[model samples]
Target chain A: MTSPQAPPALRLRRIYEVAPRDLDRAGTVSTEVRRELLALGMSPDVVRRASVVCFEGEMNMVLYSEGGRIILLVKEDRVELLFSDRGPGIADVDLASQPGYSTAPDWARELGFGAGLGITNMEQNSDLFKIRSRVGKGTVVRATILLGVPFF
Target chain B: MKLADLAGLLGAEFVTGAEHAEREVTRAFAADLLSDVLAMVQEEGVLLITGMTTPQVVRVAEVMNMGAVLFVRGKYPTQATVEYAAGAGIPLLAASRDMYETCGLLYQAGLRPAKRKGFRLDLPSGPARPAA
Candidate 1:
């Protein structure tokens, strides 16, 4: 039997092929997506939060995973984000989820965002969060947010 | 005082939000952490002073809906950062003064961070919670 398919709203709206080596580039990609989402009339508040969460998630994927793609899906009622990679998966999700838990290389911390708030902030900002991983295989994170009525 | 006036006073150059240069500023807060800035900043008219040069700085200002951001100690932002601020339409300023001195200068000039209003719980004369 085939597994159930994702809803149409969960389908990818944009797929960004970004180098998973530079956190700054990842942030730029995240910003570009958010600008388009805002232009599409998404709530400003939600867009801001989602942008940050998505940025941190993308950066984490780059720093941790071998490399991957960022898929952004927007719907009338909600937005869904998916990050997939083929790097070694998290051994202890609990520890990683902790506010200050970070395996980021020291160089990243010097860049000012590796304070270990990546997962914590993502979870805090997103309404629905899921992390799936298999040792030596990879990890995928899914985040969803309920869209608010746009003022415009 | 107007943002333009402050910019001139600090010998700082502008990046964007020039239209708001004449808008009055009433307060200032300097910080690198977005969470702290979000919790402490008063509102729309406050100027943010910080030394941390990062794109998230502009993103935080966007989220907080701040008036302007001044990078103290003559810290110039990278080209990418300037572009980000310009894209967001947030006024970015560069000042040679340190954070403390910048805050002091602004404070002496009559700009102050407004106190945040707290929620009030009315007493005996107050209306009770409505039943669901």
Candidate 2:
């Protein structure tokens, strides 16, 4: 008898790649994704959670990374976000996740972000969150927002 | 409270979306950080009061489904910001009062803080729930 084959991975309905150059561009990308999610009939609370997660991830990429890409995966029951950047990776993920701790430059503060709330905000808004980094390599963040359920 | 009422209370200048001046504002939230606003403001039709003059303010309102944005401390939005708000149908108002004063006046006028439903982490334990 032939061995049973594993099930195929879930197919994504849509994928949006946003490269944020600055805050304005970041806002644009976030807004576009939010619109798409809402159009898919996701609950308002769920969409808001996804929007915040996306915005924070986008801003972090623009601020720290040389430039990175935000990949939004629209699945049937959840929205998955992957933020990958090729920059000086975090030496301590635990320390970086702490609120009120920041390595952002002065310019980032002038833009009204870099208050050290980016990662915490992302964690708070996402149901399933993970961060992987290696010094001198890069950082990748994955956040998942389950659909249909109200976030509140 | 009506947008026009809140405008009069703050002595705000309507830069755009005058057509929506009469829309009701169910709640009010004030913050400079866009992330804080996104995380805290839970209700639709709430008024956003902020000191930030960047276009991201309007974007926040649009993404969060806010009723309108009231710029404080005499900060007027740029033309591009006004155009964006108008295009999105979100009313924009500017006031000469500072953040504290704006909140004070709005409170005096009976506008209350939006009751935010607490944020919850819904961990997937078993099978994925069916989509609604």
Candidate 3:
């Protein structure tokens, strides 16, 4: 039962904890995030991009780092996701952020991940993205997706 | 093409989501790397061609707004993965052909690439992607 309970959003916040090596339970968070976004009246385009960001962040935590938590913060103008993980932090954040530069082991590659595109994907889908990591400590990623008005 | 028609053309069978057999899907993206799928898929209702049958495949189809997934190389998903895809409402299909052949057949049938490749200025912009 370590798949992490999704507490109902008190207002516009949902938090999910991801466990390392929990490949069996991966991607559930992204699905939950998509459902919630659609329910809240967000456009499908916005929902799709946000879900991609969430899944990439979730999978990175599960496959690489020790473990981590993802927080979805929905505001009036934009939806932001906060991802923070436990150690085995990156030695160089800049190099790691580059697409196709990966340290993922062969096993992760087999499951169709660790293409070194996780960070880049998140960045591509987000209007704003930031990453900070300390070698001995951990990594924190913040991604913001701006919501546009729909002319219905 | 209709989901059912596409399945029949590939000589594939549905493992789940047969209810969506009438859904229209005109584009497809083929890859085993989930990250690549995430970065590249930009349109809604495209078909997914992959060699994997894991739950993550279904999750990607959901997240990317794909209409259905066709598994190549005779692969199949477990019950849990099928259940997840059913819940997600993304059709799942299994084909006996290898990845290369699947792509070839789909391409020959006039299915476009999943997304614009390089966004280069040299090539003519094909008819814009239809509304979702």
Candidate 4:
């Protein structure tokens, strides 16, 4: 086995273990991540955008897929989020990214979310956005926001 | 107006965060939908007015870093919701007034709803300096 690596100076300050497929945990994770980001010197505006995007993504994983992990990385200039999961992959990337497009179940909609706007909001908020997926495999989303970028 | 004033005006009772009554409130939003709240409200000192009382309400408050939550229509959220807010350090309050009445009272008190693209938060960037 390889030697373990040291925690980066600017690294994830908080780690939350959420049950796979637990939608309720989505909100809790979002709240804590936002708090940690703020404490790391991220602006409120950026933190809000990140929090919303992250929460929506987490909910998606719980509702549609087999659940996953949301890793928040705090860097000197930006906060990088990595969402990884092992679940059915997005068959149509373009369609999935479209605003108002979602595969969330009925229960998710009743809670006032899963409007297909989750990914759209994430795209709009983050300075950089990327997604990798494969059929019957899983999906990985990486989003980054500059620390001081004006969200308005 | 502060949360205490709004609570008193609406005759609402506190579920938690009674101590935060002294905190200043600069804005407010009325929506039961979490998506709209996420897309619209961004001010830190916002008073979220919603009829929907669920864990999502507290979650919304947490993610948005809202000042306080005022549940309209006299709806009181579950104890779990209250506990969630308390743990998250968010203020939670309940109001018996309907959505319209609650919004009117807050509006009359100069707590304007944010109107901007993405989200609108009207606040000074820096601490206020004492007048010379």
Q: State TM-scores per candidate.
A: 0.74, 0.86, 0.89, 0.81
The alpha-carbon deviation from the true structure for residue A81 of candidate 2, after best TM-score superposition, in angstroms, is 0.8
Off by over 4 Å in 2: A1-21, A149-152, B115-132
- Candidate 4 local lDDT, A66-113, one digit each (tens): 667788888766788888888788898878877666776787677666
What is the full ranking by lDDT, best candidate first?
Answer: 3, 2, 4, 1
lDDT, model 2, position B10: 69
Question: Which residue runs does candidate 3 get wrong by more than 4 Å?
Answer: A1-11, A149-152, B117-132
User: Scored by Cα lDDT, where does model 4 land?
Assistant: 0.77
TM-score of 2: 0.86
lDDT of each: 0.72, 0.80, 0.86, 0.77
TM-score of chain A, cand. 1: 0.85
Query: Which scores better on DockQ, 1 or 4?
Result: 4
Each model: TM-score of chain B? 0.80, 0.86, 0.85, 0.85
Task: Name the better of 1 and 2 by TM-score.
Answer: 2
True contacts kept of 4: 0.50
Please provide, for model 1 over A1-152, each residue's C-alpha lDDT reduced to its tens digit, 9 standing for 90 to 100: 54456444433388877566765665665677677777887766677667766777777776787877778888757787888887778888877877656787776666555566677767766888998888798888998887764421
What is the per-residue lDDT of model 3 for residues A1-152, given as tens digits with 9 covering 90 to 100? 43446543344899999999898899999999999899999888789889999999999899888998999898877888999999889999888877788898998888788888888888878888999999878999999887784411
| Tens digit of per-residue lDDT, candidate 1, span B12-76 | 77766677788877778877555345434445656788887777677667655678888987887
Off by over 4 Å in 1: A1-12, A148-152, B8-11, B15-19, B24-29, B33-47, B59-66, B107-132
